[model samples]
Target: MQPNQFNVDAANKLKIVSLVSVGKHPQSGRMRRADQDSRAVELGLKLTGDNHSGESLVVLHAGDPGEPNLRSYAGMGLKSVRVLQLDPAADAILPLGQHLQQCGADIVLTGVRAESGESSGMVPYQLAEKLGWPIVPRVADIVSVKGGVAEVLQALPRGQRRSVMVKLPFIASVDSAAPEARQSAFGPASRALMDIEVVSASVDDVRQAWEEAAARKRPKRLKVVKAKTAAERFKAATAKSQGDGGKVMKNESAAEQAQAIFDLLKEEGVLR
Candidate 1:
């Protein structure tokens, strides 16, 4: 009944593919295995665990096969990743959809958005359109697949969730709410083979006309404080908002000023 455990017949019969991309570290901009894509790979591995062969879950990527980060997904126990070799400027939806049709894939998993490049988060949707498969957006987890129907959890606003049943041959975009991926083992990553195949592709004319520029870092959004416990809820409901008054600590000692700033942070729950 657990997410990691599945009916052997259902798990073995269904074909699942996870599409991954090169991820960029938020601060460093270093390339790595994408976060949500890795979670999709993790879920794919979980589905294959009951069978023990890991052959049912196929990891696919449409880009350079030699990309070092692609092996990171293989480190999570995937034997190999099927890479569709194409020009970086080419749109992947056509080839990806073609491959899925050729492979007779029943379930397709993808990240909500790529960590690099245009990051429009439209690959899954576009692929679904091209393949004529239903798409479940922002999937938090794939609970089970039975009778050609897949029970899934969808991530919603404010930490809420929805359970939906999608028929077979569907696409689901993995959300950040999904389980965190396991650590990538270096040995497995080093040994994992990149199965690359050259495919026909066309450069996107629409994308070519767009202007490109460096990204500017934006200010971080304040974290929302959730009140779950009864006491916490009561505190949240009864607490009075601070006044519009500003305090000046011009005459305060160095330690007092530091303590005051720390206390302010604690009051704002930033320290916690």
Candidate 2:
């Protein structure tokens, strides 16, 4: 479907549930960076508006309990947020879907993947399977949602794009290709003291053991190559191997240079 055909103003009105991973920021390295969580919230807010029908934005977190990031999301124009906490040991997909189902979320949105732990890049697909909802990865926009269906724009390789229509309660994994997430203002971030009511887990046995697991083993040897700069990285990329012999070339015409370059690339298996 063409993206221009759908009505974005209408889609922005539907209720949305945003799933996110609360983690340390790559730049700040804080324990739980609100900036990252707020970024995800910003996208959710933009797609589905500051309010979700009458239900607030649902920020589902896995593993971490501190949840310091919720404040930033609240600061960044989100009217309300629901924190669905789950057992850190349980399967992330199952628990996340269970919580979202209880919230009655019409559309579930999440980042492509988390920045910490497994970062599997499989949460959206897995959650969709568990919830029997359509999964759309690399989502760029929500154009419309009506009659229990939603129209969305998805990013494709090489700058290509496509629009699709999926039923409500579908799952979409937001890509970096979507609009850049905004920074949180300092005043709002500091003053926002949102309430966080931790929900108790209902599961008794949450552990899953690998069948062929063995005692943690360490490798006998280690090899490390560090490059401090871009030039060093390029040098490493073009470095000669132990079995490779250096070659001598004479200055030549443009065509000869081109042929020599092709020959070198072919020898290095860079050209086929």
Candidate 3:
């Protein structure tokens, strides 16, 4: 179904809050505008224009207001953005929850994870816990918003999608499959000013000090064998790896070659 066909209440104006952050460039290893977070902002803008007419979209940041990455979002057509100035070492969950409560937004949106620094993709779940609201993760699109509820298209593995309806006052983490964000306008971005809100929040003492190292290529995954019983699992685990020693027929009779192929097929369990 098309995204616009969902039931939405035109009478009620929605207060949408989107959380954004700076991401790390995969190749350059430099700080840049986050793709997923920017997509969330784009979704917020689309929802505001398509359904909640006349209501302004709110963009929130939990880091430095002067960061170049944060400034880039202004060009995406958001009139203004609010930045919460917190210590680099502080945990963003508590302060962000307080800010959301103060804003009293009906819907909150964010990315699956930050691209830099401890990319644990846990902010949405943490924020939901703090706000006592339900979280819908990996949302592809907002199908419709009406009657204080939102119907969203959720992305799934292997090019699949599922539609879910969640009540308002919920958190949604936008997936990369959502609509791409528009290019940043230089004129607007240069003139944009962030409303910096200084927030004093305690840093989590449980976090351990860590050192950074150059990222290495990920190791290849091992093939898993599905087994239902203990004996089957043991057999699968102890099975010998296939070796490159299959027989090759070069000068055999036609019937013999065919029989050999059949035997090989039977050995591989390809034929009963």
Candidate 4:
């Protein structure tokens, strides 16, 4: 099949890649739910194909071969899919980039954060840096693709949205606002097999030393805002609030009560 013919539902198509990690279950130490891994497979499907008609799709699952999560990922979708095995000890970010570099995918889609591992939400940035490609983080939708540029919708805080266009070979960290991934259609997915594509990289190219990344000085840590105990939480809830005591007195006449309340809150640091 021709390269661009991928959109025609031919046997070959571009690949969406996701990194999977084995996460220990919070309750059962023996078994884990591959939620992040499965979500990755889910995002891959939405990014590469429309619900009905579109290109054939492939999910490139990157992780260690022996991780049981690999089987779960394999069951996620079907057709032209691959489970890429990396060194069991390899740090994921760099090795993932090396694998994608060899995979020749048109686009790489990953979740904003993994359920396991460091959970730093820095993998897409690190992978883009290593691969020398652009990254669009927290993307809510793939709006359109034409002429090697894909336009995307990005989710911002306070329910705001922004539009961006990135060239092919770009990385996108899918936000939860994107369309829900479909359930694995068993007939097709069960028919699929694990086609492993092994990518070996030069040892010298991988970045190590967490200290190097820490030196960059990113966002400051937000306060935890958590109560240490249930009693503490109850005490905090019952404690007298900012207006000197339980009740916030309106300094103005009765006609202006609502406005006065708002103004009092503004003065007391309760409202922005």
Candidate 5:
């Protein structure tokens, strides 16, 4: 089914909370806005506007409110954002859970992963476990929300998509396939306000000592598939390697070129 084909209840108003985070610049190693988290905020705005159900949108953050990164989201039309102030050394899970509970939001949206330190890409699942709510990852778009359930379009590998239905009070991690975020407006950003909530939290005790090192690229490994039959084994052993080392047809007649093109397409399985 298409992404837009879904039934929605216009009367069921929803409260959606989007979590935003600061990302790091790949080349300059500087702090910058996170595209994934920003996209989630953009999707939240699209869902809450009059075109949809007119749900209320709430922006949340768990970091230094004074950070310049937070203001970037404000420029995207968020009038205010709730900031949960916690000890920098503490794990953000506990404090974030407390604030989300206080807000009484029906749906929580976040990026697939954070861009900063220890980017484990586990926040959404961890938060779901803490709140006892179902978590949907890689959501491309929210199809509809009605009858205490939400239907969403999930992104998959190979340019494919799947539809999902989850009950209310669920957490969703937006994928990059979702709509691109709008540019942050300077006027709204300058006028935006931060609502700070100080929460007491302690760092989790680590059983093992941790170490840090410079990141490096790892060599790509060839996939090894098991073959049970002799024919399958032979086919696997002779599988074509991925590279451009084929013949090139230069200086040929139109009919010959057309025949060669047809042969190449058939070889590639692009034509019968």
Candidate 6:
């Protein structure tokens, strides 16, 4: 599906919202505009541009309104970004869902996952469930919208593509394979407004206990040996694992062999 190929009348009148989040640099650990979320905003821009309509699309954020990085998102030719002010530890789902449900928007776009925090990619799914709207996940682009139905192109594994038709008032998670976002300009970004709204904060008890830290790879689990009979069990237990490039101890004593196995297990962190 190519860009700018949607119905002009529908595009002009279409109410769209794109959800954005603060992104983190993988190496430097600095905040920036999220990648997939930026593409979502780009998609929304194209949706309105199809009809040469301006300001028909609304950009939204659920966290801090004062974050300097948010202006980068506004730099994408957006007039302002509507923000739902909440405590850092509060959950965004409740307020976001409530706002979206009452906003009467035809389409809601978001990234498949955030670059910061948990990055579980559950926000779109949870928002869809909250509003009782069907979601089209990993969508590369929306081909067209007509007759209250949207034809969307979904990104599949191995560079495959699939087309799905979803009704209006649906949620879509933009894929990384979607069109790259436009470069942000400093002039427009500086002049754009951060429209903050007053909202009651709902603390997220679950996230309150979260401790962010670096990740570590886990040890590969050893395959379990199964046997039906006692003789089979003994044979299986004593049998050497079938793999090339492995150390083999054929003439070693029982105690020495047991010690070697114990050391290997300890090195692998299989034993506490």
Leading candidate by lDDT: 6
* Per-residue lDDT of model 3, residues 13-60, tens digit only: 788898999988899888878999999988887777733221367889
* Ranking of candidates on TM-score, top first: 6, 1, 3, 5, 2, 4
Q: Stretches of candidate 6 above 4 Å error?
A: 50-54, 217-272
User: Which candidate has the top score in TM-score?
Assistant: 6
Instruction: List residue ranges in candidate 2 displaced over 4 A.
Output: 1-13, 26-39, 51-56, 63-65, 193-197, 200-272
TM-score against truth, every candidate = 0.78, 0.63, 0.76, 0.59, 0.74, 0.79
Candidate 4 lDDT tens digits, 66-180: 5544454455555545656665445556666666787687777777876555667887898889989999988776665667777777889987889898888788887767656
Each prediction's number of clashing residue pairs:
0, 0, 1, 0, 0, 0
Q: Model 6 reaches what TM-score against the true structure?
A: 0.79
Give the deviation of candidate 2 from the true structure as CA RMSD.
13.2
Alpha carbon deviation, residue 95, candidate 1 (Å): 0.8
Error of 2 at 254 (Å): 51
lDDT (tens digit, per residue) of candidate 6 on 34-61: 9999999999988876322228888999
**Candidate 3: C-alpha lDDT:** 0.83
Error of 5 at 15 (Å): 0.7
Question: Comparing candidate 3 with candidate 4, which one achieves the higher lDDT?
Answer: 3
lDDT of each: 0.85, 0.64, 0.83, 0.61, 0.81, 0.87
Give the per-residue lDDT digits (tens) of candidate 2, residues 1-272: 34344554675566677776765666666755433334456666655544323235555555544566655555565444455555665566656767778778887878887766556677788888888988888887776677877778888998787889898778888776776666555566556544344555554352444233423554322224599999988787666545335355667788888888798778767778
> RMSD to native for every prediction?
8.9, 13.2, 12.9, 14.4, 13.6, 9.6
Query: What tens-digit string does per-residue lDDT give for candidate 1 at 1-272?
Result: 56666665667777888899999988898999999999998778776563324567899999988788888888887678889999999988888988999999888999999999899998998998888889999998888888889899999999998999989989999999999998888887798778899998999999889988878864343445697899997786666655554488989899999998899889878798
Task: Decide which is better by TM-score, 1 or 5.
Answer: 1
Task: Name the runs in model 4 displaced over 4 angstroms.
Answer: 1-15, 23-40, 50-55, 185-191, 197-272
